[model samples]
Target: RDCARPQPRREVAAAAGVRAAGVRRAERGELRAVAGFFVEEFFLGRTTDPTDRARCFKSLCADQSRDFSRRYGTSDSAMLIAEDADGELIGCVGVNFGRVPAPDESSADGPFALVANLAVARRGRRRGLAKKLMAAAEAFVREDLEEEEAILLVDQKNVPARRLYERLGYKRRWADPDAKALEVVDGSVVAQPVLNLCMRKNVSGSAGALVENLRWQDVALLAAIVAGVAWRDRLAELADPLSRLLDELVTAIPAP
Candidate 1:
């Protein structure tokens, strides 16, 4: 379910300063920009292990594209792009509607649609481009692909992203149990042990529940954990201090 086809529209609109949208074939040239966005902007100065970041992105793209092609066959996966008036690549979001194979132990029926690998360039940050891309992706899934629901994973600490997802009617479906947990230690928290939050949004239901479920304290703590781990990769050293802080905060909360 991977599409390796070249999408000339993406290149043309990206070069022409107009907002371009499509699920056309991805070209080799497009990979350079996509890879660059993840490496230079997304993981810049954050990861201690640069090689690991590179490997992760490569593996993610390969896996996603393969699934895209396998399921759609003649149809390509959707990749929405937003460029500034100058025609530079400002934002990009990829959508895959291919079904994922159920695990051996799972009883889930067929494959599910997933939206992943969303990134917007630094200068393009703050604009409503991400929202537009999300809407388009949802529409594609519901109307075009006829999927009942769409799912995505976000870093537990990415506050802005979490907010965006919540606003878009997505809810925290589950926490990745295998993900490393963050704890406080010393006077300052150390990095390492990151967690990922999984979310799902039904296009047809009320989107308000997602926002109501968000707790500011939880979001802030998660953000801190993500920042610490993403920047320094040391978490155990911060666990003790964080635990104390958590205890204090818990005490401050009015008992039910």
Candidate 2:
């Protein structure tokens, strides 16, 4: 008997006659590439205090690679990663099989794939690396399971994410009419603070795309908050105005 692990076919985009981003189905255990950079920073500032922050972060980081272990990188699910020519993982997408019971009892629960844990490194932003990862996940659900649609929950406040999915072809579909709220797990001890909007995309034959993970917008908002705090000395003069601006910026940014 002969045995050699199959290498996922790499797809590339050509721009100016040069290969841009490439995407592939990450084999089992490849998720470590994602946990290394994306997960670490994603959880750093979310914890409450200095003493326990690192401890909490460590746990959260490990969860990224382990949460979907049932099908992660195996035949049952897809862990697609987008990398540069240097083989660095810049973006990742997860698609796991499950059932999303219909909004009403009119139809029984059918095979559905849940798209989650999408992340893209800062260096890879605005470069279409995310779209690449999404394409791979959709393909897995469509071709592997012969499913027509994949369902995902997006934070109701995340406009960029909503717009991204809309561009790729997902829409609200909690019922025959209105989308419904879903109380999803937030972390080790609580449910998400805000309602998660239910969205679905048609992928049975040919269709497209979809983390709520800490994003660039969050980093910038954090920076703005730190800067405003630093200006505490000028409270009588510039502090109020600067604080107002920071408030607006914070409101504009969606929570992860």
Q: Which candidate number would show the highest lDDT if scored against the true structure?
A: 2
Model 2 Cα lDDT, one tens digit per residue, 19-58: 3667777777666666655564444435456556555556
Clashing pairs in 2: 148-204
Residue 11, model 1: lDDT of 60
What's model 1's overall lDDT? 0.60
Against the unseen true structure, what C-alpha lDDT does each candidate score?
0.60, 0.65
Candidate 2 similarity to native, TM-score: 0.60
Predicted candidate 2, C-alpha RMSD: 20.0
Residue range 1-256, candidate 1, lDDT tens digits: 9987775886655434434423233443465455455444554425446565556556544644454344333354565555577556666666665443332344342355777766776645555667866877777777777775888877778888888987776787666545553222322223456567767777643455344444566678889999988767456767889999999999999989
Please give the TM-score that candidate 1 achieves against the real structure. 0.52
Residues forming the 10-long window of minimal summed lDDT in candidate 1:
181-190
